[model samples]
Target: MENLTATNLYSFYGKSPVLQGVSFDLKPGEFLSVLGRNGVGKTTLLKSIMGLTDRCEGDLKFGETDLLKCSTPQRSLKGIAYIPQGREIIPRFTVRENILMGTFARPDGKRDIPDYLFDMFPILREFISRRGGDLSGGQQQQLAIARALAMDPKILILDEPTEGIQPNIVKQIEDAIIQLNRERGLGVILVEQNVPFARAASDRFLVLDKGRVVLNGTSAELTDSVVEEHLTF
Candidate 1:
């Protein structure tokens, strides 16, 4: 496990900046939730960490290494797995093939999916030969998570993992994420609109407004008043 630290970070797309002077740190094995209304740069913050932004300024360090010097693949190889919005699984690829792609980031050069991933999302095992596009939205979300786990990441970064899924699957995904953090000891950075889940699952939380962090504290500090003031539209 490693600590991910961002200091005075600024991220931009072309000439427009999405993250402005943001600073935070995720301790080893800590579960941190990023909360905000839409378009508040919550997604951009995760992208910046993954080196996906067009340009970034300031320092992003994973453990003792400087992350700004690393490429997207380098970030992945370092054990930071990002499951972005839209659950971007390959539409034409089979479930097994999609999962194998994650192994490309493994430093050990192993290309096999872990059996635990299958146990977490049995639908993926059942649809192992099915094209990724053939799965329902909820199933695709599970596939996305399974694919990320195939890499055996130390830190899992997720953007709205439960959005638009069926209620039953939503509970399953939530339970899985909690299990990953609490039981498996993986560091987690989650960007979510679900305040209830965020509050329940996170050890700490940050509230973003516009492109800056307006409020942040331990999960116990994330109250209804804070959500109504910052998160509720």
Candidate 2:
């Protein structure tokens, strides 16, 4: 479980720069939260790590492999799973089908969502035959995470897992993440606006302003003033 490092990362949309020399390290089995106001390039940084955005310059590496050279699918196969902000689940597909999609990066013949996923998200097992669109927003979020876990990723990048969800469901998701990190040694990078949730779950914090990391510290070092200045709108 080596760290994933982004060194001097620069990303752009067309000719406009979004991330300027952004960098961070996600250590093994560690939960790191990225906090920023809207349009401050938090999502762009996540997309850059997943290779969804074009890199202007810099390097992204996990262990000995260079992630900048990998395609999105190749990144998935290499053990990075991203659950984007929207919780993109196929509306018409059954919950089972949506979860199964996560395994596409695996060898063609592989079947069955891992048993532990069902154990962690038992609600998904109950809704296996239900259409994704029929579930509540919270349920959809859970399904999105379950699907990501089906890929057996080494690093899970979650963008705002608490958005628009009920408090109870949010707690469930938080518990699941903690369990994964504590029991299975999964590394997580959380991009979130919910400061309380981020403070509760993450061991370290990274705050981005405009596009650069303005602060990097342990959770204990993330003062209220810092959160207000850098993360609040």
Candidate 3:
């Protein structure tokens, strides 16, 4: 149960800053939803947490360890798994191979895909030998999540997981996320535009506007009015 904390966090791309003075505390196994309209730094927030920005300044820590002191790879190695928005599956790699790639971040250096991943998303098991690029968008998203889970991370950062995914499987993905949180005690920081799902899945929510946190509260406070004011574009 590691706690991820960010204080006065700033992230830059080239000369411009995308995240400014961002701060939050995510407790072990807490489900947090990062909500915002398009291009309000929701993705960048996740990137900063993952150390994907060119430059970052502030205090980011997992438990007692400082994340700002760690490299991108080191962050993952320390139990932070990031599943970026595009579901960046390797085009030439097989599903199994793509999933195996995530195991490289394991501190134990274990390479086997966790058996639970297949049980969560059985389609991945069915297409174990198929090329990652050949899968449908929903399937690819599932694969991306499976790959991250294969790393056996303590926390997962997901960006727009259900976007562009089919409605049927969207429910499946959402269920898997909630199941992971409730049953497996997986801490999740999810960036999602789907308000209903966010409200349903998150224990807490943060509303980011133009790179800063303008509003935050328990899930019960994320009403339609808040969504209209901050989350709706």
Give the candidate number with the greatest lDDT: 1
TM-score for all models, in order of appearance: 0.98, 0.95, 0.98
Which pairs clash in the backbone of model 3?
A: none
lDDT of 2 at 207: 89
- Estimate every model's Cα lDDT from 0 to 1: 0.94, 0.88, 0.93
Better of 1 and 2 by TM-score: 1
Query: Could you arrange the candidates by TM-score from highest to lowest?
Result: 1, 3, 2
Ranking 2 against 3 by TM-score, winner: 3
Least lDDT summed over 10 consecutive residues: which range in candidate 2? 103-112
Query: lDDT tens string, model 3, 146-215?
Result: 9999899999999999999999999999999999999999999999989999999999999999999999
lDDT against true structure, model 1:
0.94
Q: Residues 1-233, candidate 2: write the lDDT tens digits.
A: 67899999999888878999988888888999999888889999989988887555798899888988888888888888999988999999999999999988664447679988888888899999999999999999999999998888888999988889988898889889888877998899999887887888789999888899989999888789988778776
* Tens digits of lDDT, candidate 1, 1-233: 57999999999999999999999999988999999999899999999999998999999999988999999999999999999999999999999999999999899999989999989998899999999999999999999998998899999999999989998899999999999999999999999889989999999999888899999999999998998899888
Off by over 4 Å in 2: 107-109
Model 2 TM-score?
Answer: 0.95
